[model samples]
Structure formats: structure tokens, C-alpha cells
Target: MHTSDEIYHRVLWDPRFDPERFVMGIAERGAPPKRVALEDFVPGGEIPWHRVVFFEADGHVVWDRASGVDRVGEVVDGLVGPEPGDVLAVPAGHRTAVAWLPPDPLWAPIQHIRRAHDRQIRRWPPHVNVLFGFVPEGEFPRALPLVSAALAETPPFTARLAGVHWFAHREGTTVWLDPAAAGLEPWARLRESLELRFPLCGGRSHGFTPHLSLGRSPDPHPLVREAEALLAPMTARVTELVLLARRGDEPMRVRHRVHLGTGDVHHAAEPPPPGNPGPPPAV
Candidate 1:
């Protein structure tokens, strides 16, 4: 039978990007040898299942013990390889195994992740629009969630399934700001509609709430009165709604919905402009 140490050595020495060159030995004594593409054994439909090795890129293994039984049998031939307890290096992305099996083991982890993703989609609320908002310095404590709740009635047009999100501002808040620009026009209209509908207090500041970010603020009541008093007379327009996502340590704007509101009406006391560029780089 092949020793676990031997298998480990082979993986360490031959790791490479060329999926075809890599080879896995069944055992020391059993079956005729065989070779195949590494991708065939991946478990998941798109992402696939592979063991991640120590190498930066070349470390990955894909094998399905159940469906690939015939393939594995061909690779091992009839050799009485390592017993169930003997360890073997499958591939880099594959999960750790106590030992190598004569035939590969069925890939189960991929199925689990798929099921979880489906469940998350099913549980999501249909009406919620997931958006992120940054709390301007003075705006943090009171404005975040309150604004989010106020706009709960607005429906998400893009990802109708994912609920709106108002992530805390900081370094991470930039992700949502970029896409916000797209909804500026529609947001401006919405703001105008709101101003026309609600009694505006004098001297209060007013701003358009992008459909996605309507519910992002924590509690904006304190500022609401002041903002309303300042903004009642002036019109509010939103040119875009920024959709941001974390990329590495910084936030990146991943998506944008422009011209959300009807016509344009610039608001007074609009917060300083935010920084960041187009939809966050694709994953």
C-alpha cells in the first residue's frame, strides 16, 4: 500500500496550474493506473469543491467519490491500496481527510453550501430594498436606522429579493454611496413628493432618500425636525443611489441606480460629496 507520507510528498513537489499534469496514485499495490482532468470531480455546479493547498494558486483538488466511482476504480485498477485509515493528499481545495479511500468519497460539502444559499434566498423578505448608508459625523447616533424605517414602504427594483441594508459609515460606508448617484433623479422626485405631501417645518434641512437607502439610518428624528425646518421650502433631488460592497480592507461601490426620482430639485444643505468610483470591481 502507498504510505501517506509519499502522497504528501507528491503534492508538495508537483503543485502546478496545469490541471492535466497532476496525478494521484491510488495505492502502493492495487489497480491499473489512470489519469483525468481535475475539474471533472468538482462538487458544486459553479464554484466547485476542491481542497486548497498551501500554494497560492495551484493548491486545489476535485474528486467525487460517489459519481466518479467508475473513474476512481479505473485509476486504482485492482491495487489493494492504503486501507481506510491511510492518509492521502487529494487536492488543495479538498477538505482534509483522515485517509485516502480505494475509491474517492462522495463530495458532500458542496451540496451543503448550495442548500444554505437556497435557504437564505427563500427566507429573505420580498419588499425590503437592501441599501447601505454612511452616518455623517453628527448623523451617526440618531439618523441611521430612523431614516431606514421611514422609507420602509419603498420597494427595491433591482434585487427585489435581498432586503435593504444600511451599513454603518466609517471606511465601509463608501460601498453604497457610489451607486446612490444613479437614483439621484428619482430620489429627487421622491423628495419633492414627500415635501409636497408632508407639512414642512421652517428652517429644517431636507434631503432625498434613495429608495434603497430609505431605511438605512438608525434614528434620524433629531435631525429630522431641524432638517425639515431648513428644507421645507427647498426641493430635494437624488441623482443616484450608491451600492457598495467590501473589497479587501476598503469599501467599493459595486452598483448604481441613476435618475430614481422624477425631474430634478437640488436640496439645500446637501452633505459634502462622498469619495469612491463605479460599481465595485466584479468579484
Candidate 2:
């Protein structure tokens, strides 16, 4: 996710411009992915067209847009999203844009996001997504056992999931729900347990903001208001925890799924088993 500082280099929500239009700015001369320079760009009326690309630590994986597109990457079929610090091709146009979009609900997006989450639930194994901070590949083992123990010690509970809403972030507007409102106690329990065990996962300066992300909205202001009106809060029962491995060429694989209430646990997939040249596996 682009922080406010970084996103400001691209788009903005201005009252002076038309709500339907996103204001795209000119990137510095000769930036990779081409700097956008939309003609007749208006503050709120019509902004520049923009698209973005995400980069993994090692090299380019999949463009957040799609595959049928070239220059961004192999023209794949589906569209993914950009992670923190990933490059973006900030552009928008009058054409029927089909890729890298927001929740396209005409009314309530809460239902849309909930449906998406439910679809994901049905496909991948269910997991209690507790915050452990992000451990680099090198520190995976150092965090695995601690996180595992924390999961073992924790019990299952229901988390309230309000309908999806927009967050006016520096990185455009992100659509997320506040699960902590209902899952606060359990969340704290897990955080404290994990923190006491490891250095914890977050930076020292920033606290934690546990959220279930739906997606980032290109245009946030109207959607935020519409979401506030149409989105309905719901609940998700916390029972199991799963470690998901994302691959560029395949469906996200489930490394493991552990039932929270029961002591029973099983490893669905083995590590880079024998000859893997990497740190220990982790969620």
C-alpha cells in the first residue's frame, strides 16, 4: 500500500474537480512506466489517466493490472493488486476501463466485499488472520514457532465484520472493515502473546491497525459515503488459521490449516521440503 506521502505523487480527491474524475498528476520526467501527462487536465473535472505496477523484493512478478496487457508484464488473465512500494502507471481515460478497478456495486459494496470474502473462504482454507507483523524471508523460522504457539494458546471467537467502507488513505482510498471493534479482546490477546514471544511484527513507532481489506477504491469520496449508507456490518466466526502461499502462476496455496478451538492440527503442505534454499516456512 502506498502511504499518503507516496500516493500524493499521483492522485488526489479535490472538491474543485468532478467527483467522477480522479486527478492524476505528472510524474517526474522519464519515470519508468512512463510519466502521465493528460491533456486539458482539470483539478476536479478530468485528471490524467493512470495505471500501476507492483514489484516484489527480488524482481517483477505480476502487474497489478492484467495479463492481456503487455509492457506491464506477461499479458495474464486476471488482475491483482500493488503492495507497498510497488510501481504504478497512474492513468485514467474515457474508455471502458476493465482492469484494476474498485468494488463495482451500484448500491451496497458491503455485500460485494462480503461475497468476495465468502468466496475466498470457500476456496482457500479459513484462517484467523491475526497480526504478527511481516517477517522477512530470513526471519521466517524465528517467527514460526512463536506464532504457532500463540495460535495454540488462543481460542476461537466470533469477530464482527462491518460492511466494507472506504479509508481516505494517502494511497488513494482503501476499502476495509474494522474487525477489531468486535474482536478487540482476542486481538489484543494474540498481539500481546505474540509480542511477548517475538520482537512482535510491527515497527516501534507505529501501533497496529488490524483490518480486513476489501480493495482500494480509485475514487473514494463518493464510495465512502455510499458505503456508509449501504454497507451492513456482519460477523465472521474465528475457528481456524491457515498459512497461504501466493504463487505467480497458480492459485494461492494453503500451507497449513489449524483449528483454533481443537488441539488438532495438520500440515497440509510440507516445507521447500529438503533442498529449498530459503529460510524456514511461515504464514
Q: Name the best candidate (by TM-score).
A: 2
Q: How well is each residue in 65-181 modelled by candidate 1, as lDDT tens digits?
A: 333321211223222222231122222211110110010111122122223222222211101122222222232223222322223323332211121223455432211111233
Instruction: After superposing candidate 2 on the true structure, give the runs of residues whose Cα lies further than 4 Å from its correct spot.
Output: 1-129, 136-144, 163-166, 225-231, 248-252, 261-263, 270-283
Q: Write the per-residue lDDT of candidate 2 for residues 145-173, one digit (tens) a residue.
A: 54566567778877775645556767676
Deviation from native of the Cα of residue 103 in model 1, angstroms: 61
What TM-score quantifies how close candidate 1 is to the native fold? 0.18
Clashes of each: 85, 19
The candidate 1 region of ten consecutive residues with least summed lDDT is: 95-104
Runs off by more than 4 Å, candidate 1: 1-221, 233-242, 252-283
Which ten residues in a row are the worst by lDDT in model 2? 94-103
TM-scores of the models, in the order given: 0.18, 0.44
lDDT of 2: 0.41
